[model samples]
Target: MKFRLLLSLFIFSIQHLISQTIDKEKLLEYYESQRYADAAQYLQSMYPSDTKDTKSLTQMAYCYMMSGKLPEAEKSYLKVNSIEPENVPVLFSLATINSRRGNKAKARAYLSEIIRLDSLNFNAWKQLAGYGENADERLKYLKKANTLNNTDPDVAYDLSMTYRELKQYPQAYEVLKTAIAADPGNFTLQQAQLPVANQLGKYREVVENGEKLLKENTDANVINEMGQAYFYLKDYQRCAALFKTLEDLGVRNEGTLYFMALSYRELKEYDKAEIYAKKTIDEGISNHTSIYYTALGGIYEQKEQFSNALEAYKRGLTFSSSPTLYYRLGLLYDFNLKQAKNAVNYYNLYLKNKPDPEEKDQIEYAKARIAALTTTKELVKK
Candidate 1:
């Protein structure tokens, strides 16, 4: 009778244990239905302790993450990590959470661990590139990522930009070209190709690629690049037309104004050229102010407005003692204004400043003029 009673008790205990056990499929059904909160609750009730159930713990972490319970998600992920220390997905999740939380150091540590376990992890290398301490480190990681996955447009773009930033123009151009070939309609890669081509002195390529971009989208940046390409090609009319569009669009910065002024000047529209050149000066891009003033002076010289030309050149001198400006002043004073003394002074100033190698001919001419002017002055004094 005692043995039968014990057997009945054991059978009841087994039935109770089976009833209390949670079905993973039921939890998955809740998760798959987008009932993440319900799944989390069910998992919590079933696995109340930090059990060795990595799958359940990972699902719970995902649920916490999807529900915006980041702290809880992090705790659950850590629990999974404790159980499966070399788990790449868990490590990557922890890295993502730390990155989103602005914990860069911790995120980097996690990514480093991932790479240590699986060196071919492209995503881990790409993520690490963002957290690099310097440009060289970033470049290193990006290059590795690119080697692993050259087909990704984002990876190609990033690697190309890194090379461009380091002034490795040829590499940038090559990478961008390969990326464009793979994804021909990628506007970003096409646009990026323009500047690198320009840097490589491939102005014709800029025009070709830039025109292609313009056909698809009338982006202001694409228009500006096309205009620059035209300017370099000496297609002043086309350059001026494109720049006018930019001006009409209210995108008239100092660069656009300078290009517009130069284009008009090349086309001999002196009045319009002077207007844009002076506008460039008013825009206060100090680095190019000297060039604007010089262009304005050249326009006045073309119109034979000698006094205006002189004033413009003098204003330019205040900003930059450019040898070319000095030479222009010497020519204006000597030939047009008939100020031999001032001409001699300017010619002397031009010689004193080290002129560019391309100005060798101009330097020789100045020397001859100075000698003649000084002789004339001596005879006049006598």
Candidate 2:
């Protein structure tokens, strides 16, 4: 009986090898020609999918992936994963597909499994690092990745950037130096080095290195750092010029504008200084105060909270007597609160502000209401 079973198993193995050889030849005709869609079709037709081997399923999945048939690829990979649960390469392929599909949690789970099986797996750790939700979590994963492979340019860049985001400037600077040394012609590494160098008060180094990097397409971060470096070096004229370039690029932020203002002042350009100082305040705070309050009041009005709407408008008047606020207050009192005297007073205040040409309808309404309310008050008194 044992001899019969052994002979039957050998016969089955020989048949399977013959079938696999024929499939491989047919598949290579399409696959070697880079016709992945054709190869996927051929692979899927090889046998009933329910009986296909895991190796054949994996090959089909790879063809599907190359052909941009993500759903088909995912299904094939899933079947392979179930059959060969301990296969690391299959796990990695599953993670890649899930990530491409925006299934971040599933991708992370597969990556976690890879590391559990082989803790020294560098690609799994690096890919897992990006799944972290916060800077601290990202920093922890990135540190692990960086340790596993310090010479990896991408890992070094990400580690340095995470350190910089957390205000660990010295560590950020050090990481980039090692990566840059390994790949000296890397412009991205050079770009990242500027801000940390400036933060560490290495102004001369930032300027000397930054000047060679300036181009039509230089990033705004690099320009901002160069502006700061020039300012600290007391090169006021060049500082103002660099900030002006940022302004032209539409990259002006509050800090850059404030520095621009100071740079102009140091260069004895008072008018430009005043202009930039006003811009700094507008960018930093206060300029949108009235608009913010107006939107808040409108939200309250939408919720049918008339009292809250009135209060929001009144508070906005205290910040800036924006004509729009006066108009809103008048509308709430006139239509909702039934306070004729309060409505009339606010309408008159709104008219006195002489709002813009766009407020012509509002101005006309205010004028007509004031006249009607004043006459009604006299009649009530009588």
Best by lDDT: 1
Off by over 4 Å in 1: 1-29, 285-382
Clashes in each model (backbone N, CA, C under 3 Å)? 0, 0
Q: C-alpha displacement of 245 in model 2, angstroms? A: 3.1
- TM-scores for all candidates: the values are 0.68, 0.80
How far does residue 78 in candidate 2 sit from its true spot (Å)?
Answer: 2.0
Evaluated at residue 171, the lDDT of candidate 2 is 90
lDDT of model 1, residue 321: 87
Which residue pairs in candidate 2 collide? none
Each model's lDDT comes to: 0.86, 0.85
lDDT of 2 at 199: 93
Per-residue CA lDDT of model 1 for 313-346, tens digit only, reads: 9999888888989999999988998888888899
